[model samples]
Target: MSARRLTLLVAGAFCLGACSSLNPFSSSNTKIPALKPLTAVAKTAEVWRGRVGSAGRFVFQPAVFGDAVFAAAADGTVVKLQAGRNVWKSSVDMPISGGVGSNGRLVVVGSPKGDVLALDAESGKMKWRVSVNAEILAAPVVSDGMVVVRSADSRLFGLDPADGKRRWVYQRALPALSLRSSAGVVQEGNAVFAGFPGGKLVAVNAINGSLMWEGAVAVPRGATELERIADITSLPVLGSRAACAVAYQGRIACFDLANGSTLWARDMSSSRGLDQDGRHVFVTDEKGSVHALDLSTGSSAWKQDQLAGRGAGRPRVVREYVVVGDVEGYIHVLRKDDGSLVGRLRAESSPILADIQLSGGDVVVQTQDGSVYALGVQ
Candidate 1:
């Protein structure tokens, strides 16, 4: 299953971004790497299981807020699960695309027709609906005062949380070729960090929608458009003093949080995404190998290639382990000190596209079929 896709939305010999990825990693020629027998150093136990409608081609991740897990499906079902049981299930009355963004009070999602639907978190009732006039592929982020929605046309809208009214809009020139990713933005404090095509990461003021600073996570290179298809396809991972991101056919880097300056960088490529913890940045490359990089210097601390050729999503850090889900629906836990497989558990048979989230100490992930699973690491 293709996690994300390349929509020329292309003018050259095929498109870029994932087109650069699409060519080399096409499923026809790619084979799932065999998993070697692993001695389970840790144990993963299923805490609970919940179900939602199948996502179809859209990406829907389960959002955890306290004990509540909000998840949606492509078929217009938005279900809020508490303890893996439905607290409330509502319908948007339209096919959904991007979603499951919540900041406790407001649960927000996007419709296929570009409508941004804000629902009350407690009751799962519709609060407000506004259209961005473009299809929403990535989830719309919501908070108490502000809501940031990324439209398919590469525009970000800052909306009023009270009602889905536009506060401000931030639009950028998109590259000719790019990957249409379900990856969204990260909002921390007053800044909203978003990665874009051409491998640029920008910090926008959440209050006023002003550009705080821009950092080049990766600059497009290569002679052909496909080779030049460097785009950041995931959310920027935030650390204490730095914000780091990865770009396909590009690099993995950390930028200074204050000024958006590149703190450290190394040649890397990953459409999947990454996580930052302690002194290391963990990323899954395009071909599905996971690596740990030194946070301060971008040095490669270790690499785990056992899962190569298996589609892996962004990693989530829990305690001393890194947990990731793959296309084959196997959750692999790696030792943080060294990239060794520590534990493995099977969740389903479908592909897991969404990021592995954390619910307290348990790991949570929603597969392509919209089955939400919570695993306790012991």
Candidate 2:
């Protein structure tokens, strides 16, 4: 069998096992809570709703440029929407497993087959395409005239934004067993950051892909693979001087952005990502509870367990509220000051696995059924 085929088979087996062990619908000891009817407190209006394509079991978040939004579906359909209307629609002609990263002029996406595609953001015309030779499950980030992508096999590639040519590639050895998910990549100035399976976070030059610093967000500990799983599956949240990251079965830590020093860390576990504002950090724990911690001290501010076992997505902080979605298609709005549930809206009947995007004064959500909705809260 070919190497690609073998990788796919292994991924399939891992997915099956993960579903049996982690799926809230299974007859396991854990029970996913039925969503309670929300008593609306804040006013929410849907700006526009449209379909891109089905995400199936994959995660795909829409990207918001200046006045437009770019979204890609699992079937390779990419759409650009302006003022809630379709501006242009195109396809990569291959299964797009990750993407919708844009910088107004150029939009980039990735496929499970390792194909990285760049398109004109305004015209939806294909500009260039290249292969990274590994599965890209996270959205590609474009910044500093470079496009950064992370593959499932722990390789990071920096490509030229103009022609999709390889600029630099960084590879790290993988553990014998690790989670299939990734922390994705984030760019700040000339530095690009990514989290690895061993709970390590690395910063590199976006232009040359040279290592800047590497720090451990969580340290693996235990006897079994499941017990020792400390993968940083969420995108690292950057603050003014520090970047915070979470690890499954490991601690959430804040590291100094300049020197990779551990600023603060606390015993916390999460499968999803985190969000931070000026004062506090918000995280969704493994059991589906969301906690607010002091950004400077890593002390717990509040914990909201109302959505426990509901398969919550990552948190996105808007002006005064933090927004999160669930596997059941409900968008929960919580007051950032105290972690209280303030408002809830249902986008679709399907599960929402992707991170919610806060665009301008609106929130953009993409459901598993391939529907994208822009909503405004008042």
Alpha carbon lDDT of residue 308, candidate 1?
A: 83
What local lDDT score does residue 267 receive in model 2, on the 0 to 100 scale? 88
Best by lDDT: 1
Among all windows of 10 consecutive residues in model 2, the one with the lowest summed lDDT is 19-28
Model 2 scores a TM of 0.94
State the displacement of the C-alpha of residue 27, model 1, in Å, after optimal TM-score superposition: 5.2
How many clashes would you count in candidate 2? Answer: 0
On residues 1-378, what C-alpha lDDT tens digit does candidate 1 reach at each position?
332233443432453333534333233555678899989999898999999889997778888999999999999899989878988999989999998899999999998789999899999889999989988988878877899999876799999999888999998987767776778899999999999999999999999999999999898998886678788889899999999999988998899999998898889988889999879999999888999999999988999988888777788899999998888899999999998999999978888888888999998888888898799997
* Each model's Cα RMSD: 3.5, 2.3
For model 2, the local distance difference test gives 0.85
Checking candidate 2 for backbone clashes, the offending pairs are none
In candidate 2, position 283 carries an lDDT of 98
Compute each candidate's TM-score over C-alphas. 0.94, 0.94
Go through the candidates in order and give each one's C-alpha lDDT: 0.87, 0.85
